[model samples]
Target: MENYFLGLEAVHPSCLAKIITGDKLPKKAIIWEFTNEIKPIDLYCYLQVKYGSPNGLQNFLRNDSSDNLIHWEWSLAGQFGIVSIQGHNFRTEVHLIGEHDGKGLTLEDFIQQIKADFKNHGKSMKSVRVELEKWTRFLNPYHRINSVVAKNIKSLNSLDVKVDEDRELVKFHEENLPKLEENWKYVRDKYDNAIGITFGLRSMLPVLAESFINLIIFVLAKPEIKKNERLLQNTIRQQIDIRVQSLHLNCIGFTRPIDYTDDVCKKFHTLMNERNDLLHGNVEVNKLKIGEVYFKGKVPVFVGYEDMWQSAMGISLSSVKYNTIFDDHAVVTNFIEFILDHLSKDLKEQVQYIMTNSELGYNPANGRLGSLFSDNIADFRVSVNEA
Candidate 1:
């Protein structure tokens, strides 16, 4: 059994100074020694080629999507010492492989599958010129998916509003918004600002996240096909990722069951963007201020804790089950069960083994009461004859 420590770190400026000699002096830095078994892909290099940073490393090979403009920051401890990487979309798979998928899917791999499918099956909106236009230049954009709200849109038809009339689409948006609005009351009335104050609301966050993931999966699921659904779905994924990252939020689980089409994904993304704006202190919309948070890019907005608590409860009602439970309180319990489900069966086995055998073995501080916890020592260990 082994213990994995996950915590923040403090860096010594003298140690970092040598590495960043020609660069700016370090003031506020979050540096740590990298000790994970898995090797890290150079995010700056990845971004320079993948995103085309205005100033990339010298003699670095350019990647296919060099036209993309993404920026973010990441740090690691290489063999030499500390490595700090700041740029956009510089993410490597924190998603462990073989948790749910025996073979984890990479963006490159997904793209290859789409290209193959396109070459073979094809879709209603396939064309060479369209193919060139539809390809992704960057995974992360500074403005984020929500930033494009100010972009040109000839009509909602492009957005797949499902209705022929523009007014009907707007009407539908107005009608469904009450759910998100009502949720605010549930969360805001409860906890004040605390680290985990909105932890429960993270579940609802995935509702939006999964919707976006569905869009990416939609594109990757297809072959070289250029379906109208492709870009729309990508929009959903892009918007959701940006929102999640911008809010500095994390998900408790990921469960999206969308068929994955471009148009469907776009619709959900659009809905989430509007919701984020209204919920995060936005005042432009009539009566929006009575309750809600407004989203301002680069400006961190925190939702009322009470609104999220209720949404968390609502999620439980929708998920979790043990003899078909009912009642509102049950929703939270079910949601907990659901978030635990985020750990795949394989990962759960790993966690269980680590918890029981490792030094960190179910810290008394974090586990359930000893009485409530099963005395499985004899069950999993020596099979004892009952006295």
Candidate 2:
């Protein structure tokens, strides 16, 4: 908690004259919800005019290039000590801070007083009728997909190793053949699950990449690019490869575009092709070559064919291995990094913040103000005295 009182010492003389010091800190608070129709700045301006210059006012802003307001605090005249007023996320709260001795203003009393003031000042402070709704766009889906892919790979590896161990046991003792067969069943089931999960990853990775790049352009693109709806739509609708390659040059005026031949760029295009194959239901199948031969007492029991035949279809997803998924995931991450690296320092930092935080703060007028992380909230003042 920060001692906002320390700053109050320098308040204007007229406001300071009304300030009162108390032995006990204020504990009671009254909150009023406002419709989004009213902006926080408008209410703050009104308070400034009504109470003259406040003892202290602080604007808590987003930690991004936008510098949009997250919340604000104003210390005004108080009968007890200093009354604190805060506007945050479409709500205003007034805190009572002084020695009341049971004779100070009550909650209802202050509510009526504020209501009258609003009415006299020609302000229509409407109370919220419905619960506040919050919508968040999570930016870390790539990371989540990577996690699922990793877990699937780990499960597959464990099943494969078990199957190999069972085969070795069967070789030593013919009676262990049943165990080997059972382990093979486990491997088959796991393989089927992996195929399905990997297919989803393949489909989503490309889409996530496209969404990410377009999001960057939408949020941080040059003013002219943003203002023209048609241009913005056309740019976003372009082939993902074109968007990825041109992101730097199109969004930032001077940076060089990523070369199509760059390894990262090439990898991204390959991922897109794989996604396209899946989307278009393109199938390719070739005769699988048999590899290892398993024998049961001079009788061939099992013959290992290439892994491709086991795929859901002859689709490219059939060739996906754990390493392949890892590489594809890396391509998206690396390409995003490459694009961000070419951005100006400030833009890079802002985009990085958006990517790192899970929840985006919404402003009706601005769409997205920025993100707010739990740690950022933890560091902020929880109460007026801590402001």
Candidate 3:
């Protein structure tokens, strides 16, 4: 395993005066952070055009295998440094390595010189804008899917009431009930369709919640857990409840575990049970009752029957109501908020910003100014470059 150290904070253009005071360059690599307006790719392209290929004295080499928009190397004063833009969160960094003969010049002067060079020669790169637009298009479908689900649930509830009313009318008119088989069949068909939608939505809710929870883990898991592929896989494979509880320990390092008594946790546990019952084919039989009917010209008829209705199997689809779907969705949101509440102020702010705006790209206005770094410096170079 390669040893790693925390690199010096990258001097942002705005903080140069206060931070970069001395001529002595940092012993460790200095990570320079940039905004979306000026991405590392934009800088790379400009340098490529100005300095040609990376083979020359002003070497500029791009890692074609890297998923990051800006995973490249540029030689400044004969020393190679990495310039990378993280794909997951669009956090840009230029890791300055080794030393330069700045003589009496301070680090501030060197940064100013680089900015001047870019200002004089660099052209705007469309990569950042294009990537943001692509993400926007990707997210649009999810919004439409959620809207359709809500609309279908509303329709299902309305149809459910009608089916119940039809059943009641058929029971009261027992003599004509046999003759109304076609009407009953038609009603059953409509009921089946509406109820099928609810079942499908119910099954999907747990899946969506689980996926989101896994996403949070992926984003916020401790460095030790993330770096060990086997450990990460094991953690993910654990029960959903375990994974949820582990978030407090692994990410936030809280000695106290997440409170299962909380409403959010209660809802999440219910969703997990539902998902398990569905996947494991746990059939729960529900009894349905019909009232006794009296005839006008004959002895009163009492009709009673035993029926097996499994909610998970859609035998009792009515059991999975709109509120169930709503509650399942609410639990995911609530659980996210619940976890956020436990995080430190800085971590909570960063995590919230990343969760909300990562799809769109990083926006400094929403939270902390610079890129969020993991514990391992090598991770800064490699993990962020992966898709």
Task: Return the top candidate by TM-score.
Answer: 2
RMSD (Å) per prediction? 27.4, 9.0, 17.3
Q: What is the C-alpha local distance difference test score of candidate 1?
A: 0.31
As for candidate 3, its clashing pairs are 10-31, 54-60
lDDT of 1 by residue, 129-190 (tens): 23332222222221232122212121211333221242222232656466655544533332
* lDDT of prediction 2: 0.57
Off by over 4 Å in 1: 1-190, 193-196, 199-207, 210-212, 215-220, 225-274, 278-281, 289-387
Q: In candidate 1, residue 233 scores what lDDT? A: 44
- Candidate 2: residue 374 Cα off by (Å): 7.7
lDDT of each structure? 0.31, 0.57, 0.51
Q: Kindly report which residue stretches of model 2 are placed more than 4 angstroms away from their true locations once superposed.
A: 1-45, 56-71, 75-82, 87-93, 99-108, 123-197, 219-223, 280-323, 340-354, 357-375, 379-387
lDDT of 3 by residue, 1-387 (tens): 011111222233223322234444343345555556444555555555544333221113333432334444333332222222222235545444434223232334434555556655544433333432221112322223445555766776666545446555444376756766676566567767766777677776666566656656665677787767898898889888888778776664343567877888888788777777766777665323223466768866545442322222234544556336556666766776786677677777766655443232223233213223321223244322211
TM-score of each: 0.18, 0.58, 0.44
Per-residue lDDT for 132 in model 3?
Answer: 29
Query: Residues 1-387, candidate 2, lDDT per residue (tens digit)?
Result: 122222232345444344433335554443334444344555555565465443444442335332333455666544445666666553566555554435544545544454445555543223221222344545454335445555654654554533245334434256756686674565556656666666667777777777677767777666677778888888888888777766775686326667779888888888888788768877643322223568888998655444422332223333654347757777888887877777778877877776655456654544555554442332223443432
For every model shown, the clashing-pair count is 33, 0, 2
